[model samples]
Target chain A: EDKVVQSPLSLVVHEGDTVTLNCSYEVTNFRSLLWYKQEKKAPTFLFMLTSSGIEKKSGRLSSILDKKELFSILNITATQTGDSAVYLCAVGKSNTGKLIFGQGTTLQVKP
Target chain B: DVKVTQSSRYLVKRTGEKVFLECVQDMDHENMFWYRQDPGLGLRLIYFSYDVKMKEKGDIPEGYSVSREKKERFSLILESASTNQTSMYLCASSPTVSEQYFGPGTRLTVT
Candidate 1:
């Protein structure tokens, strides 16, 4: 069965502290991995990684995938209160382009 | 910009009542998906459509049915609303399976 797991289900950190969120997935015919940040309502796209090793970054957030290890990590630097949200990871299959998502990590940035 | 819109931000329904959730995507994406978000379960796929009138059962399709009469619209139906079905419903769309854009989500409460 295809499954996605995330580590550190919840985290609380100071405003300036950096945090790392992990996601590992097992699925047939891996195509891509995606990251999303959900604040109070909807989720916004963060990053999409298809190749291994190469990193995708936007502002203070960056992510990378390791297909060989069947895992991915999201790194956030210079965190702020606005960055407090639920981070979600989803793995897409090549055969049908369907995705399987993880439980997500809740990060709270304290001032 | 990819804009996925849900019909409501919040809804309340009585137990055993039939419920319908509507979603529309502006982008001419080929894939549309419906998912429910819970506290610890993250987002679980309920149904998806690759094209008009072509529906596929997702990981959690029980007790739910979907309609995709047009390319830009997808609707989820709950034959009988239950307390356990109260959740945040999310709608997403993608050109393919790579990156999905999500709606603001509808918070449904059943009594």
Candidate 2:
């Protein structure tokens, strides 16, 4: 049974604050991990990590995966009200292209 | 840019009625997926298609059916709409077994 769990189900932060969202997974033949941010209508892709230790970053968002530990973390720096959304983490299977997703972390950035 | 589109953004259906959700991708991706999003359950895979006319059941496929008549279109059908089936349905497509591009999503309400 593949399972993905995320910590800090909800968080409240102020402008310029930094936040870290954690994701842990237990799956067979783990191939990749992905992050997404959902505002209102849809979720936008953030980062995809396959290798352990190496980090992927965008303008103010970054993520890293640790295959050995079976976990991944997404960090958002200089948070703004625009960053308020539900962050989702998902793990993909190598052979089937199937994905198992976590419950997600809801972050509300205050002005 | 990969553009995944859903047939509806919001839909309301009565109990025991049949419902259909359509998805299309312009990128001609090899794989397409259907998932349901809930408040605390995250996104649960309902079904997926690797190619035209080839469908596979995901973690939860009960009471749902899928169709992939064309390479770029995938449809999810509910045999009988129930109140418990009300959710946000997401459609995604991928070129390979990697990062998937998602559609804006359809919010379905069953009364």
Candidate 3:
């Protein structure tokens, strides 16, 4: 069965702290891995990683995938209280394009 | 910009009542998905549509049914609403299986 697992189900950090969220997946014919941030309502797309070793960055957020290890990590630097949200990881399969999501990692940035 | 819209931000339905949740995408994406988000469970796929008049069961489709009469609209039906079914329902659209744009979720409460 295809599954996605995220580590440190919840985390608390002070402002300006750097936190790393981990995601590992086991899927047949993996195509891509995606990261999303949910603040209160819907999740917003963060990054989509298809190749290993290549990092995708946006502002203070960056993510990378390691296909050989079947895992990915998202790094957030200079966190602010506004950055408190749940980070989700989803793995897409080649056959169905359907995504299997991991239980999100909730980050609470204290001021 | 891609916009996915849900019918309501919050809804209240009585137990055993029929419930409907509507989603519409403006980007003309080929795939639309319905997922239920819970506190611990990140996002569980309920149903998805690949094209007009085409639908498929997702991971958690036992208590949900979906309709995609047109390319831009997808509706989720809960035949009989139950207290346990109360959750945050999210709708998403994607051009392919890569990056998905999500709508502001609908929070449903069954009482």
RMSD of each: 0.9, 0.9, 0.8
For model 1, residues A1-111, the per-residue Cα lDDT tens digits are: 999999889999999999999999998888899999999978898998999999999999999999899999999999999999999999888867588999999999999
Candidates' C-alpha lDDT = 0.94, 0.94, 0.94
Clashing pairs in 1: none
Worst 10 residues of 1 chain A by lDDT: A90-99
* Model 2: residue B72 alpha-carbon error in angstroms: 0.9
Considering only N, C-alpha and C atoms within 3 Å, which residue pairs clash in candidate 3?
none
Docking quality class, candidate 2 = medium
In model 3, the Cα lDDT at residue B92 comes to 95
Residue B54 error for model 1, in Å?
A: 0.8
Q: Quote the lDDT for B26 in model 3.
A: 99
* Candidate order, DockQ descending: 3, 1, 2
Instruction: Please report how far candidate 1 places residue B66 from its true position, in Å.
Output: 0.8
Q: Please, what are the lDDT tens digits per residue for candidate 3 over residues A1-111?
A: 999999989999999999999999999889999999999978999999999999999999999999999999999999999999999999998967589999999999999
- Model 2, position A77, has a per-residue lDDT of 98
